[model samples]
Target chain A: MTRQALPPGTLDDTDRQLLNLLQEPLPLTAHPFAAAAAATGLAEDEAVARVARLREVGAITRFGPFLDAAAMGGAFCLCAMAVPPGRFDEVVTLVNAHPEVAHNYERQHRLNMWFVLACERPEGIARTAARIGKETGLKVHLFPKLKEFFIGFRVVA
Target chain B: MKLDATDRRLLAATASGLPLTLRPFAEVGTWLGLPEAEVIARFAALQAAGIVRRIAVAPNHYAVGMVANGMSVWDVADEAAEDLGARIGALGFVSHCYLRPRSLPDWPYNLFAMIHGTSRDEVEAKRQQVAAILGPALRASDILYSTRILKKTGMRLVEGG
Candidate 1:
């Protein structure tokens, strides 16, 4: 079984149901929240308010449409770099400043700094990695997805 | 679907998030000066065309305390990689599984799976289960646990549009 920890918040049964419902594809209608309200047995106003509260408290990172970059003629790749310990902070700032860098993380490995680079250009991943390497003076390793077996995330609420 | 200027504008308006209101589509329409019905229709069309994967909430995994994230890389036979990948991807514990190009003479793994758990031990156990599934087909594998999230945000097409 997958291990999971309850999110921090004063949540009740209603909130848990709401979280699960929110992960679903919302109805695209004139009154979409109404559908959510119906599912959660809460008023439309209350449902919207609760979602807003969840976001404010950082329980929900984002609530909206998830766009597919590849389908939209964009490029993306996972990259890693081994930055010197002394220059880690400076390199992080430089890497994050680039709009092309989607997300980055520090991992427990020799090649520590890992990030996602995404852009509309077909060769954007390579170009961005090259630029990051030149700018940070660290060797950037590109790990682009050759094939997708699965791509989805769901947390048991 | 080919998104024109108007479609781009609409997506730009809600790229960060949908307006927190009873009628988010209508609100977006108001912001873009387009009819509410038109906005709703276009949004639906975008989804049908697969440009928009879905309208949903992305929960904060860390905030939820499922902090352990292990990027498991495996060296599987090139011929059987696809079949094994499909099986691994179907596992409930594997949040993301993909076949990534590996750099030869250095990085030798190709199959990658992003597994999440509440702790390192949990993630390691999950990795073992994945190995058990792979059996002898798994030549080699390694898990890289993320220590910190330096930056995180979804891909954006337009810059603050």
Candidate 2:
């Protein structure tokens, strides 16, 4: 029989359970963690302490409301550039220098560098993409979404 | 749906993160010098408007054993794309599924889904699962594994209201 995969980091079963709960929307009340604490069989303070520790230990990156950029009247466009592997890092720095470049990733493909431009307005998308193209001396191919089938982000800890 | 000055301040004040306390909203209220009631009210309103997707832990995928992720793209029949994409998005392993326009010649994919797993093999397995779902409707497909995350700050509100 195959063995179960070990939980990552130093998280115990309780921590894992708490993480699973935390990934979903917390209560919008004054004592948001009260229900979570009760569910995890921990004191409210203890639950808060654990969450703070998780963040400090780098297990959880951020503990806040995930604001939808598009809902906020902002624009986001996916873009890609094919750069010579030799100059990848330099090109990455150039492309990522812009504040509008919200997320950038190096992927395995002919168009190796993939990034998302988050702009204050729809027009800003093209402008930021053009700037990156000019600086990197590469074609910035934009792939805006025609439609989205958003299946919420949830990971079992 | 429109954010007034107060809403902007609330968003900006807690952009980094919400305070972790029994009465965390009160703490955020303190930071912005607003009463706890106002902070709670604003958060409720923002969430109601769908601007705040969720207030929860943004776990590090790598730290949580979800180390492998791939942008799986496909060239699909335009007519079947919407129905098939919705099905793919419903799968637990698929986080983001979208229908995008093809660039042609250089790029021919019009559908994209981000698949995640604990390892590359698992990722590929999930990719196959997606393929099975697409069946004959899928003309071509490719999986782009992320080698590095150059930058990844989720959409932050930059301009002041």
Candidate 3:
């Protein structure tokens, strides 16, 4: 398979390695990027510069520790709803207004609207669902994760 | 460990992202007026406690040419779902695999896996591979292809923040 071209003049070998290294936890030391820089055969300053550039160019969406809502005394649920094509935009506006709604995506199915709701409390999920349903006049189907076998990715950029 | 005022503030500072710097901890420390060692220690402790999953870069999958994304749902035997979920989750192409409750008479899928590829056909091929792996234990399945991403963000549910 042919590899797709990265954005023009965006990422280089060092950036790739740095991105991969960042996918793992950073060492709990004073100079975390130093280890990554050494591993990628780049100076610490250069590694930091490359990462900064990557962030500027949108190659890296976020560069920081990922926290789980559940672990932090919160709740999350995957939800789905069917909206007529005409009302898609309006529904989106209404649903996205909720701070609890973390992600909203349109999928190709009868239940076209799918989103993940994250709240500070487990009961908050159902309450938010009720609010969304009442506001949108559509039944919201909840799909809270019962067991997570795996839930992550490491894209080799 | 329970989060106090300082921890919440720390999380908020880096919620969007931490600065891409050589001494990221030092930078955060300087901004928060805490020592570099203390910043590192707190973050490490949070990670060990499972509050912070990992410090990493989140790539835009679409930019990386992973255009075809499908959320594959499956209805498997109640007793075998856990075993099958583990097997499915282990696949290289499966980014997220979980066992979720079925919506009863309206929806019957209890297992879900997210598959991304270059095209729909590729996703379908991977789905078939999962089918082969599950064999008779898999009762039913469907692939929900994402047509549009209206909005996507890491969870930010800090109360009153």
DockQ: which candidate is best?
Answer: 3
lDDT of predicted model 3: 0.84
Flag clash pairs in model 1.
none
- The per-residue C-alpha lDDT of model 3 at residue A72 equals 76
Q: Residue-pair clashes per candidate, as listed? A: 0, 0, 0
Q: Which lDDT value does model 2 have at A125?
A: 94
Per-residue C-alpha lDDT of model 2 across residues B9-98, encoded as one tens digit per residue: 889888888987889999988888999888888888999999998889977777778878899999999999999999999898888999
Better of 2 and 3 by DockQ: 3
Per-model lDDT: 0.83, 0.87, 0.84
User: Residue-wise lDDT of candidate 1 within A38-80, one digit each (tens)?
Assistant: 9888999999999898777766878888987787777889888
TM-score of chain B of each: 0.88, 0.91, 0.91
State TM-scores per candidate. 0.87, 0.91, 0.89
- B2-37 in candidate 3: lDDT tens per residue? 887778778888887787777889899999999988
**All candidates: DockQ:** 0.54, 0.53, 0.55
Arranged by TM-score, best first: 2, 3, 1
Which is superior by TM-score, 1 or 2?
2
All candidates in order of lDDT, best leading? 2, 3, 1
Q: Residue by residue across A42-127, what tens digits does model 3's lDDT show?
A: 89898888888877666777788888778777788999998989999999999999998998999988899999998888899999
